[model samples]
Target: MSIKMMPYLILDGNGAEAVAFYVKALGAEVMALQTFGGMPQSPDQPVPDEAKDRVANAQLSIGGAEFMLSDNYPGMAYQLGDQVSVCIITNSKEDSEALFNALADEGTIHMAFQETFWSPGYGIVTDKFGVNFQISTEA
Candidate 1:
C-alpha cells in the first residue's frame, strides 16, 4: 500500500468564500464538498443551526496537488492564522488507525477515528508539537 499527504486549510467560517477564491485564483478543481447540513443527522448531537451552512469538508486539486479544508466546527475556538494542517491519505484502515493512535499520544484527538460518510476510517489529531493532522482512508 502507498501513502500520501497534503496540506489542509482550516477556515473560520469562510470556507465557501475561500473555495471560490481558490477556484478563481489557483484554478483548482473541486473534487467534493460536504456541508455540515449534508452530514447524516443524529438525535444525540444534531448539527447546530449555525453550522448547517458552513462547510464540513471540501476537497480540491491544483494540478496534481490535492488539498482540503473545512470550516471550524460550531462552538469551537477559532484562533487567527491557525489555518493550516496536514492530511494523510492511507490505503488501509489499520494504517490509518495506527497513525491516529500514534499522533494522539500526548496530543489532542479532535475527532476519534471512526467510519464516516466519506471514508472507512477518518480522524483528526493534533500532535504534541501542535501540528494537526487529518487521516483519511481511501475507499
Candidate 2:
C-alpha cells in the first residue's frame, strides 16, 4: 500500500510556540493551524478555557517534508521526551485499518478505527513497545 509518514509532536500547551520555533530553526513554513477554540463545539465535551487558545493542530513543511504538532488536551498529563508520535497516511481505508490493528495487537488502542472529517479512516494506537502511532487514510 502507498503511504506517507510524518512526525507528530504533542507539546504541553506550547504547540504554537513550538511551531514558530521550528519554522525559524528548521526553515519550515506554516501550512495550516487550528486552535482548540476553532474546533466544532460539542455540548458533551466543551472546550476548556485553558485549552481554547492552545493549538489543536498545526501542519508545517521543512524542505518539502510534512510536519505536524498539537498541544495536549486540557487536563491531560504531559511527559517530557514522549511528545513525538509517528503519523501514517495510507492510500486506502483497508491499509489504515490493517496497520492500526496490527500495531494495536498486544498493545493499546487509544482510538478504534473510525471515520473522521479529515479522512475516511483514522485511529490512534500505542504499540507494545510504547511507540504511539496515528493512522489515517488519505481523503
Best by TM-score: 2
Positional deviation of residue 78's Cα in model 1 after best superposition, in angstroms: 0.9
Model 2 C-alpha lDDT per residue in residues 28-106, reported as the tens digit of each score: 9999999999998989989989989999889999989998999999787788988999999999999899999999999
Model 1 stretches astray by more than 4 angstroms? none
TM-score of each: 0.91, 0.93
Off by over 4 Å in 2: none
